[model samples]
Target: MPQFALEPAVIEPMVEALGFELVDLRVAGSAARRVVRVRIDLPGGGRPGHGVTTDDCRRVSRELESRLEAAGAVATQWELEVSSPGIERPVRFASHWRRYVGREVRLKAVGVRGKARATIVAVPDDAHVALEMEGAVVTIALEAIQDATLVVDWSTYGKREAGES
Candidate 1:
C-alpha cells in the first residue's frame, strides 16, 4: 500500500476476511486530512433479515486502521468509515446482477435514450445480463451499462390497515 494511495486491492481482502462484502469504496481530501468511506454488506447482500451491523463496522474500521498503520500507508490524519450500502445501491458486477435477479433496477445504458426501470431476469455469462423491460427481454453486455441501481419499492412496507397517512 503506497502512502496516501489506498486502492481496492489493499482493502478488499481485509473486508472479505471479516466475512463481509465490499460494496463500494471512496477516498477523498488531501494528505492533511483524508476520508475513506467504505460501504460493506453481508456476502450476496440479499440475505433476508440479515445485514452488516455497527459492531461489524467497528471491527472493520479497527482492522483497516491497524493495517494502514502497520504499512505506514497514511502518515497524516485519516478517517476510516465502514457501513452498509444504502437502498438504491449501485449494481455493477455480474455477481450483483445474479444476486438481484427478479429485482427491478433503474438503469442507464449506452445508446439508450434515458434511464428506464427494468427487472433483471438472467445473467447468461460473466459479461452479459438479461433484463425484462417494457414487456420485452433484452440482453445487454455489462460494458454497455453506464450506470444502474436497485429500485426500492416501498409500497408493501409497513402498511397500515386503512386511512393511515
Candidate 2:
C-alpha cells in the first residue's frame, strides 16, 4: 500500500484537541488531484441532530489545514474536505460502538445469519459488544463484525415537526 501524506497519527491529535473525533481519513484521486476526505464527529458520539455541523467542519478544516501545512503533510496541492459522519455512520472502533449504547445498529458480521439489527445493550471490555436482540442480550466479538452502521430514527422528525405546528 502506498503511504499517505496525512497519517492518522499525524492528524488525530490535532483533531482531538479541537474537541472532535477523527472518524476516518482517506486520500483518493490521482497524485495530481489528491482529495483528502476527513470524516469527523463529536468526541463521545453525536446523535439525533446533535452531530458535527458545517461550522464545526469549517473550524476543523481551517485548523487542520494549518496543522497539515506546518507538519508538511500536504506538500502538493490538494482538496481538503472536512465533514460529519452522516446518519448512517459506520461504527468501527470499540470506543465508537460503546458510545452508542442503547441505540440501534445494523451489523453485517461473520457467523451471523445475514445482516442483524439490534440495540446496543452493553459494551464490556475486551473487544466484545453486547446487543439486545429479541429481548435477549447477544454478545459478539468486535472482530466478527465486518460492518456496522447506526440506524437513523426518522420518527424523531415527526415528533419535532408536530410540536412546531
Candidate 3:
C-alpha cells in the first residue's frame, strides 16, 4: 500500500490513542531514504489556553516509536520530530475552525470576497464559519477559505476600553 493509504489506516489511530491529534503525515525523500514526518497536536485542554507542550511531544513520540516498531511499519532508519504547532499554524480543516472559534483570524479566500481578517465568532458546522469583520458579522463557507489561522493580539486583549469600571 502507498504511504498515504497507510497513514490514515494505521498511523492516525495509533497517534490518536496517544492523546494527540494527527495534523498531517507525509513521506519524503527517495526510496533509499524515506522520511515520514508526522505532525501532531495536543488534545484539547492540554495547556491552559489550548497550546501544545514539549512534554506532550515527548510522550507522543515515545508511544509512536514503540507502536511503529512493533508493527514493522518502517524498514529503514527514519527521523521522528514531535513538536507543537507553533504560531501561524495553518488552519487546514474544519476541526481547526472549531477549535479556534472566538479568536481573531486572518483568512484568504479563493475567488470569493477576496482576503479578509476577522474574528471567528462561531463554527455552526463543518460547512461554514461565522466571522466578525469591522463590526459586521458574516458567514463564510468553508470551501471559500483558502487559508486561515488564529492571530494572537496581546495588545487588544490587554488594553482597557473607554468605559466606566
Candidate 4:
C-alpha cells in the first residue's frame, strides 16, 4: 500500500546480483528522518547461502547508499537497512508460492473457516495456491488470503527422508 524510496524496479537487479530475493522494500517516516528497510530472502529455507548475510547486508547497504547519494534521491538523510525477512516472513506475492512449493505454510483467509496450516503442494496459477492439510488438499484463491507465511518446522528438515531403507 505504501511506496518505497527504492522502488522494486531499482532494487531487483541489486538484490539478484547479491544472490538474494527482494521480499519487500518500504520507507518509514516523513520528511525529517527516513528509514528505508529492505527485506531480503535467502535461498535454502531463507538461510545464509543465496541469502542475505552480514557481509551481504554491508555490501548492499553501501551500494544503495552510494547510489542514492549519487542520484540525490532523498530530500533528507535516510538510514538504510539490508537484512533477511527473518523466520516469519510473509508470502505476499505469487512468486513466493512458486518458490516455496513443497514447504509447510500457515495461511489466514478473510472469510475462510479458520486459520489453516499445510504443505504447499502446488501453485496452480498466479491466482491460487494448493495446500495439503491433514491428508486433504485445498486450493485457496490468493485474493482470499489475508496473510500467509512458510511454517518453519525444524524437525521436518532434520528427519530422515521417506523410503530411507
Best lDDT among the predictions, by candidate number? 1
lDDT of every model, 2 decimals: 0.85, 0.83, 0.72, 0.75
Summarize candidate 4's per-residue lDDT along 40-131 as a digit string, tens digits. Answer: 76653355234457887788788877877776666686788888777767786788889889987888886666877888889989999888
Ranking by lDDT: 1, 2, 4, 3
lDDT of 2 at 112: 76
Superposition error at 97 for model 1 (Å): 0.9
Provide the RMSD of all predictions against the true structure, rounded to 1 decimal.
4.8, 4.3, 5.2, 4.5
State candidate 1's TM-score. 0.71
Cα displacement (angstroms), candidate 1, residue 28, comes to 4.7
lDDT of 1 by residue, 1-165 (tens): 456888768788888898888887788888689999988888878443467788988999999899889989887798888888877787876888998899999999986679999999999999999999999999999989988988987774334557555
- For residue 25, what is the lDDT in candidate 1? 76
Clashes of 3: 0
Residue by residue across 77-114, what tens digits does model 3's lDDT show?
A: 67667676666565656777888878878888865466
Model 4 Cα RMSD, 1 decimal: 4.5
- Give the distance in Å from residue 32's predicted Cα in candidate 1 to where it truly belongs: 7.5
lDDT of 2 by residue, 63-118 (tens): 98888877677656689999998878878777778877889999888887788899
Judge candidate 3 at residue 139 and give its lDDT.
Answer: 89
